[model samples]
Target: MADIEVTSTCEEGYTVESVINGEWELVVDALSNDGPSANEVLAADYASCYIPAFRVAADKHGYDDVGNIEVDVEADLDEDDDLVSIAFDMSVEEDLGDDEQDIVELGEDICHVHSALREELHADIAIESGV
Candidate 1:
């Protein structure tokens, strides 16, 4: 497996700048200026990753041109203030047969991000901060 690394920098405030492969930069900030909050970022990332999975699933079922699939992901914090659960509603611009909806749902399992979150896969989390 290839090792991928991204770097992020932030000041005391909410804005964060992330560099991907030392090439691309994305600025994620609090929603004050209509920027993306951390919660919003997670929702967007999951949805973005799911779209390709949906497309691939549609193709596998011998149906192309499913059109752009729109995924809406909503997440909420649990009692302990941890982001724990996500609910999604999707819409495919084109019409699929009655049974084809199941195929689309099956494709959702293909997204690694979605799968990891859904299954609550363990992660080695490390934090370094001055107290």
Candidate 2:
């Protein structure tokens, strides 16, 4: 296995400063009142993971000209148990001559983030829309 590290600092309520390396910095904010909770982190992670997976799936299905894949991830928090559930709806504009269905199916199947979240975090997930 390889090692990866990211550093994060909290400035104020529900907002965090994150750096993957010394060069890049990102400010992340949480939507809920509680602020930059684990829910927001989970949502970001899901979004990041799904896009790349979809790209790989697209390429495998001969979508050589696949462009501008968009993924929206939402994490809903359960007040009772304090669990966060995630969902992803992704769309990609591709011009695959005869492999559109294959590309879509492959993209859906290769969404490892969804499976990992379901298994690791027991998240309730719905792939609401895809194309």
TM-score of each: 0.74, 0.58
lDDT of 2 by residue, 34-119 (tens): 44555666677767766776678777766555677666666665665354555556566665545555655565567666666555
lDDT of each: 0.65, 0.61
lDDT of candidate 1 over 5-103, digit per residue (tens)? 689988758788888888888788874453677767777787787778767877787776676665656677677646776666667766666645566
Q: How many backbone clashes does candidate 1 have?
A: 0
Candidate 1 — which pairs collide? Answer: none
The window of 10 residues in a row where model 1 has the poorest summed lDDT is: 122-131
**Candidate 1's error at 29, in angstroms?**
3.1
Predicted structure 2, TM vs. truth: 0.58
* TM-score top scorer: 1
lDDT of 2: 0.61
Model 1 error, position 31 (Å)? 6.7
Clashing pairs for predicted structure model 2, backbone only: 14-36
